[model samples]
Target chain A: MTTLMNRQYYLASRPAGAPDSSNVPARDVPVPEPADGEVVLKNLYISLDPAIRGWMGDDPNYIEPIALGDAVRSSVIGRVVKSDSPDFAEGDVAMTVGAWEAYTRVPGVMLNKLDEAAGIPLSTYLGVLGPTGLTAYFGLLDVGRPKAGDTVLVSAAAGAVGSVVGQIAKMQGCRVVGMAGTDDKCRWLEEDLGFDAVINYKQCGDYEAAIRVACPKGVDVYFDNVGGEIFDAALLCLNKFARVAVCGWISTYNVPDAPGPTNLWQLVAESVTVQGFTVIDYMDRFPEGIAQLAEWVVAGKLQFREEIVDGLDNILPTFLRLFDGSNQGKLVIRIPEE
Target chain B: MTTLMNRQYYLASRPAGAPDSSNVPARDVPVPEPADGEVVLKNLYISLDPAIRGWMGDDPNYIEPIALGDAVRSSVIGRVVKSDSPDFAEGDVAMTVGAWEAYTRVPGVMLNKLDEAAGIPLSTYLGVLGPTGLTAYFGLLDVGRPKAGDTVLVSAAAGAVGSVVGQIAKMQGCRVVGMAGTDDKCRWLEEDLGFDAVINYKQCGDYEAAIRVACPKGVDVYFDNVGGEIFDAALLCLNKFARVAVCGWISTYNVPDAPGPTNLWQLVAESVTVQGFTVIDYMDRFPEGIAQLAEWVVAGKLQFREEIVDGLDNILPTFLRLFDGSNQGKLVIRIPEE
Candidate 1:
């Protein structure tokens, strides 16, 4: 039998601004057989998230920065082609912390077995019923802690986590306002996702004024995904005793030496709590988050959009769509099974 | 009583940097007669806190900005010279939100009647056992939430609030590190207050390096009283899930358009919580905090310093000492009872 080959994009060097081919280079190598308790999988779905951009830089260690020469770290679903442990079998589908590659070799203990016959789309696990859903579930409810009638403002509102956050806030009886980069995304948020108000930040001349118009009651909870001038504006719009749940600063991840929010003193002005967290912070409650999210998706209470870009060759450009706000909803790279 | 002439410092104009005579002009105006529920106090001890500087500016409304033509807002302990309410009688000593004036006329309900016969210096109510102590008590315990063995680092560690915060952390069974401007203050924190380690921030080459040297375990709780480059450095030294209890940013209060802490991205990196609050946030629980603090003071477990400057004329200069870090501990203006 011919040897299986893996096409992978590995971190060649840390990028100063937006990444290029020089920083992340691609190559083909022989797929290694599973060793000890390891399982080798042919990747089918690769989640493209702003967090992946964060892992590429070494500036902030929210999670451990992806080491040089390693395949860029990501959440991936794959079909197990080889296994050295009883936990996984050949052809069994599983999800794990993998990489930007055609094949992934992971420890059996790290893999979460997925059921393909359950009728739930496999890609949903990478989006609404997985880490993306869990991030919104915990970050909003746990950090934001919105009460009924409280105004919840979400930045990067069209993105996977922010969308889920706004939906969850609405269910919590909050007046949900969203800020997205494009008019299309704004319409999607207001018309489709049930956001009380949506600000097309691209057209909004002054962020503070736009936020004020959108949130008359002022923002009690601000789920911040994009941190920069927008984050600075949100600081000014916060209500007394407001809470800023910082999920990630996606806007500043690619830029070198991004300026910190200038209006942090508003914290004292309003007695605010600005907390930073990641989905991994709730590792032990993964099962609970997945079950609750699945229930919502099945009962038709939750609505989400998944933009799937096919082929491993389109992975890099597909991922870049996240930074420019071009892609809709949860972005995923699909490599169809041969 | 000879028609009382109240000599008070009123805000003439908003100051650009430090308030000179023009910004805060003194005028002798006729004292207003007691209203139906009003009690007039012959001001004895005026509390000069860093928070007073924030009230002088028209920006960041933590409390209502001291309106133009209004005397600079402060906390003062005084003798009730006149009373129109049954709750207060003439010669009763009380503490209330007064001003930089010889006498204050306030509603009887706003006054916290002090027991001068309890053998405690009435000025101590303005420092160790009043808002200053309660600030440290709630800010360190409620916000910082140190879990015995946690490393607590305090900036402006010799000031009224910081000094008390370090002592409170010690009682909670934590390794306490302090950062102060002078060797004397550092020595006081180490030798007198039982701080495990101390850093003279002015002499220290880099704030981050000094903090690392002083706190080898990394800072679990950073009680920040001064914010600026020192705060940027402190962000770099925070451990995972660290809590930053921001009492006030005295450093930037005077500097116009002071750049914010540059390394705020560390919040996401460490899952940190940065909360800003005032003692007023705990107004409902003030009695509880004051009682607990008084217990610690009575047992000799808590130590504080108060620098009392004589005469109301020295109020502006004495208050400015806070910005320069010159005055040690709680700085107060004392006008001897006539």
Candidate 2:
């Protein structure tokens, strides 16, 4: 058998602000054989998340920063090419926290075997049916805790996590208002995703006014994905005892000197609850989340979209699209068939 | 019966910044007669709290703003001079949400009869055994949720709510760090309040460094009463899954253009929970809080202090002392004996 080479991206240096080619560069290395209790995965899809920008920063955060010369950390959907553990077999599709690479050698313990018979695309696992779905599930339902007739406002509403958040809030009998970057995205959120109202934030000059018009009764639960100005506007419109789930702050992820919400005192004035969470914290309950999310999808209550990039070569540019608000839904790269 | 005149302070105009004589002015009117189900309360001890500043503002808040020409809202301990309801009788001491006045016509339903034989000062009911104590109890225990090994940091540590918060956190077997304005206050917190560490924020120019030295293990629970810089500093020292009880923002109460915390994203990075609450929201649990606090006070496990200003004539100046950090503990104006 001929030796195969694996192309991967590594953290060359910590970026000052937004990452570019200079900070994260690609390198080629020979694919390694699966050792005992490990599996050799042929990566098919790599998730490009706004969270990647946070992991690239040198500051202390929810998880350890990616060390210099290390393969950039990411979540990937891959097929096992070789397995030396009882948990996984060759040709099995699995999901794991892997690297931005064409092939990865992962510990069998880290892998969650995918059900190819589930009839959903494997990429959905990385979007609505995987961690992204779990984030929207637990953050909105558990953290936000919306009641029927409650007004739920979501930012970055057309994106993967926000889209799922709006749908789940709707399923819970809430009046959902979403804010997205483009008119097209807002239309999709309203006309297609069943959002009660949508605000194209890029065109809406006064977000507070737009929010007031959309949510006349005031927002009872704010599912914030894009922080900063939008967050401040939402704070002004919060009803008494409102809940704000501090999901990803995608807008400020790249800006090192991002300003915080000035209206945070509203949290006190309105008796609001603002909680920040990561999906990893709920790892023990993953089975429950996955099962529930699957049921929602199967019942036609939850819908999702994927903006799939064609190749690993376009990873850096595709990742940048997350910050620019260019990519809709869950941004992922489909690797070249080997 | 001889006619009695009532002396009161009214909200003349909404202050552009900090309130002064022009905004909150004094007036004299005839003492109101008790209507059906009402009692005429001769205000004796008036409680001065930082929350009063929020009420003076024209903007919407937890409670309705003090409308112009309305008696400035306050919590008062008084003796019922006249009663038209069976719930109250002449000469009975009670606590009620009244006004900055010599006499208030209050609904008997709103008055809580105080036990004169409880062996605690009637004014203590305005402090440790009243709304102040209840605020600390519920805000710390219910919102902060400190574990035994947690590092609890409290701002305005020598003041009413903060002082009680520190003592109770200590009772819960947590290490407590306090931040106060003056060295004397810090000393009082460390020497008397059982705080493990204290930072005199006035002298500690670099609050973040001081917090690092005080709470080496990182803050697990932050009971923030004084917002602005001290609050921002505490945010930087938060441990994973930290809980922040946003009790008040005294520092910004006087400053109309207060800067918001820039490091708020740390809430997301650390998976923190920040909740804002008022004692009013937990009215249903007041009996539990009052009982527990009374037990602690009786068992000598809890201690409190009151800065009493003699005479109703000192009410305005006494209220001003709250924002200036001139009062070491709970500030109360003692009405001269009638």
Candidate 3:
């Protein structure tokens, strides 16, 4: 058996603002041969997300920047093509941070075996049963600390993590309000996902006014995915002792100059808490998070949707759909069905 | 006795860029007699704090502002000159929240009996073993959650609250750093209050550099009293999971417009928690907090200083001391001991 397989590598040129295909060029390269405890995986699905925008920058962050001449670092759902250790078999499905290409090798330590026979789709491993799932679970429970009957307001409502967060809040008996970019997403969130209320931030010229109408009792917990003006609007409507979990500032990611709220005095008046967190922080509790999220999805208490594009070449444009607020749900790049 | 009292009102003719005696006025009238469930007290000491500046303004706040015609509202340590309440006696010492007056008729519900035989000075009730002490207790332990070996940084080191905060952090086995307005205050914080390091913001000129020097391993908890530049400096040096208890922003309080930081992006990278709170929010646990603070002081584990000024007329000037950062520790007006 040959140890080598082809992988994708991004080349020189970092974007000044929003990234385009011009900035991320995939190149074919010799696959890394597995070490003593490594596995070679055939890429199946790649998680395209707003956080990936941060990785394109050279600035220091909680997570390391994706090097200019390396495969775009992403969470990938793949099948084991070969294993250098006894832990994994050739046909085993696994989830690991891997390349954009067809085949790659990753350390056994970083890979989690995925049970494809468990009735969850392979794309779910890149979303609802994977990193995004863990992010929503830990971020809401640990950071937001939503109480029963608390009013929870989530931004980017129909997005992968936001949808999960609102559903989880509802499961906790909270009154959930969602802010989405479109009326279609709002309708989906309200009718399909069991959200108590939905606000189309794009149609609502005054974000704060929309929040006021949506949350008449004031927001007790805010799970913020899109920051900037949305965050500003949410802050003004916070109840005393409100909890704000800042997961990602997707709105600010593409803007060359991110303009935050000028009225931060609201934070002081309400005795609120604003916390920023990375999904990686709760890695130790991933299994427990995934198990509970999977149970909720299977029980129909939580509903998730994936907007998957069928080809690898469409990955860049599909990724851009998130920034433009055009993607209706979890945007997964479906590798051409082998 | 006539139903009137001699008190001072610090009327805000215009919001002061820096508070001065010109913005305040003194008035006199007959002392009011007590009503049922109320005590007529002669104020022993009135607390002069930076928070009084906020109360002087017409802006909406946690507590109501002092109207131009009304007496100034501040915390006071008083002796019951006369009483109609079963809980208080004529000679008993008590703490109340209506100060800047020679005499006051206070409700029983708002007064706490002070143990005159406890041997601690009466003015100490206005500071340590009082609201300031409780603020430090709950803000650091309850909100900040400092663990053993953590590095704690406190701004306004020699002030009533920060001094106790540094001492309590030391008791928790944290390496405590204190930032103060003067070199003398910084020296006192290190030599007398058991802080591991002290930096005088005035001398350092570069607050960020000073914080780096004082907190070598990075700050795990920041009890922010003087916000503006000190908070900006601490934000830069916070470690992952750092907690900032925003008890007050004294540095920004007097300014017409509070200048926010430019480097708030650091919050995302460090995953810091910034929470604002007041002692009133923890009123249910006040007894526990006060009891613990008193025990620490009695055991000589906590030490404090009071800068006392004589007469009710001196209340405005003594409070002005807080804004100028002239008062070394707790500023108290003696209220013309008669």
Clashing pairs in 1: A62-B269
Higher-TM-score candidate among 1 and 2? 1
Clash pairs (backbone) in predicted model 3: B4-B30
TM-score of each: 0.99, 0.96, 0.93
The lowest-lDDT stretch of 10 consecutive residues in candidate 2 chain B is B311-320
| Best of the two (2, 3) by TM-score | 2
Cα error, residue B261 of model 1, in Å, equals 1.7
Which lDDT tens digits does candidate 3 get at residues B1-338? 54655665546364567656566766676776778788988888888877777777765466777777666788888888888899888888888888577887888778988888978788888788788888888999988899999999998888999898999999999999998878889889888887899888888878888899888999999999987777877888989888999888888777876655545556677788989888888999988998899888889999998898887766666677887789978888886654
lDDT of 1 at B285: 96
lDDT digits (tens) for residues A115-150 of candidate 1: 999999999999999889999999999999999999
Query: Which one wins on lDDT?
Result: 1
Task: Kindly report which residue stretches of model 3 are placed more than 4 angstroms away from their true locations once superposed.
Answer: A1-14, A89-91, A256-268, B1-5, B10-16, B19-23, B29-32, B57-60, B86-89, B262-268
lDDT of 2 by residue, B1-338 (tens): 65679899999998877788888888899986888899998998999999988998867788999888998999998998999989898999999999999998988999899888866789998899999999999999999999999999999899999999999999999999998899889988999878999998888889999999999999999999988988888889999999999999988888888877888888789999999999989999999999999999999989898998988877887888888888979999989775
Please give fnat for model 2.
0.77
Candidate 1 ranges beyond 4 A from true positions: none
Question: Candidate 1: lDDT of B295?
Answer: 92
